[model samples]
Target: MSDALVTHQDIALRLAIPLEKAHEPRVNTLIQDSEELIQDAFAEVGRDYRLEVANLLQRRAIIRVIREMVATAVIVGPYSGARSVNSSSGPNSDGLTWDKVPEVSFAGVKLTDAHRRALGLVVGNDFAPSWNFPPATRWPLRGGDN
Candidate 1:
């Protein structure tokens, strides 16, 4: 009930698990951790978490990789084009723009938010942003409900 964000340590304790449970060779942990992180981020943004969780849970399988690694924020941005390495664009620039996009005011919002924002800017454009966490590290995002 404190007006503060929760940490992964708190969540781990609650599960009677370790902060590294996210890397315990199980897929479900990734999904649950991602879900919890998304929920917590939304809560930070003053969103109705019950509704958001319900919406994301409907497609849980898609986000199942999050437990073992950091879920991306590219999904939260707008798409630009074929999005491949080409002569026209490379290394993070597809020449995208944010027009009518919902502006987010919180930090650590997930990649899904970027996707939604990108869509708001352009209905059919594909946008992706790299959060750039070392893929091999698999740091389970910490803090929520903890």
Candidate 2:
């Protein structure tokens, strides 16, 4: 019942998923499940900038979570052939193979360095201020001008 940080429309647009699928209950559940992680990331931005950080970073985080959920479901779902297999030999070879379920990688679901930078949760190298230097009067000065 609570508001989602990213909408089905947003996910459809960003992830190129069908609108119906993006709006599915399972997708919404995944988004809701990721709320705690998103909130924790937002908390790292500090109180003063929390609003702004959430405004900018929540969509990307939600998209990542949704993608992860879908991937995991697909990898372990019945359609993935994890418990069954088809063989070209004959009916004798058509029995269940009982293949190991693939290990789904969730790296993409976590917040990245770039996301942290955008949210101001992590700072990059600082550049020294040039305010003390006088403005150059000429455009094509030689290297010795300094």
Candidate 3:
């Protein structure tokens, strides 16, 4: 897509998928979709991605986050609603399970707290003040220390 932040090549290299697979229509579509989701996330935090991440330093950081977001969407595909999957061979056989945390998984391409931080979006404690105020001065013993 014209405004896609990551290209098929980038996705392919990141996921170690065949370049041909990355060029498929599904992957291409996911690339554009992921970027749109990212833009929405930026807007949610009142940050204009194009404006705030234009600097060289910010660009590198934001791009890495964006790429990971897109890769996740592509990897998760359309079946993002399932939080966990369990497979077992038999009653007492080996089993494999995969689990995902909601905050970290967009189910497809959702923005994670880490992503917001990398983009400089405000999250808990990002703006927390650390200054220690001096103890309040006690009033003179007006009541004789009552």
Task: Highest lDDT: give the candidate number.
Answer: 3
lDDT of 2 at 138: 75
Per-model RMSD to reference: 24.1, 11.1, 4.5
- Write the residue-wise lDDT of candidate 3 on 28-96 in tens digits: 676666567667877886778797557778777766876787677666644455555566766755444
Clashes counted in candidate 2 amount to 0
Instruction: Report lDDT (Cα) of residue 111, candidate 2.
Output: 40
Can you tell me which runs of candidate 3 are displaced by over 4 Å?
1-3, 17-23, 76-100, 103-107, 129-146
lDDT of 2 by residue, 14-76 (tens): 554344653466545545544555567666555433454356565554455545544444334
CA deviation > 4 Å runs, candidate 1 = 1-25, 54-146
| Candidate number with the higher lDDT (1 or 2) | 2
In every candidate, how many clashes are there?
A: 21, 0, 1
Per-prediction TM-score to the true structure, in the order listed: 0.26, 0.39, 0.61
Highest TM-score: which candidate?
3
- What is the descending TM-score order? 3, 2, 1
Model 3 scores worst on lDDT over the 10 consecutive residues at 98-107
In model 3, the clashing pairs are 106-110
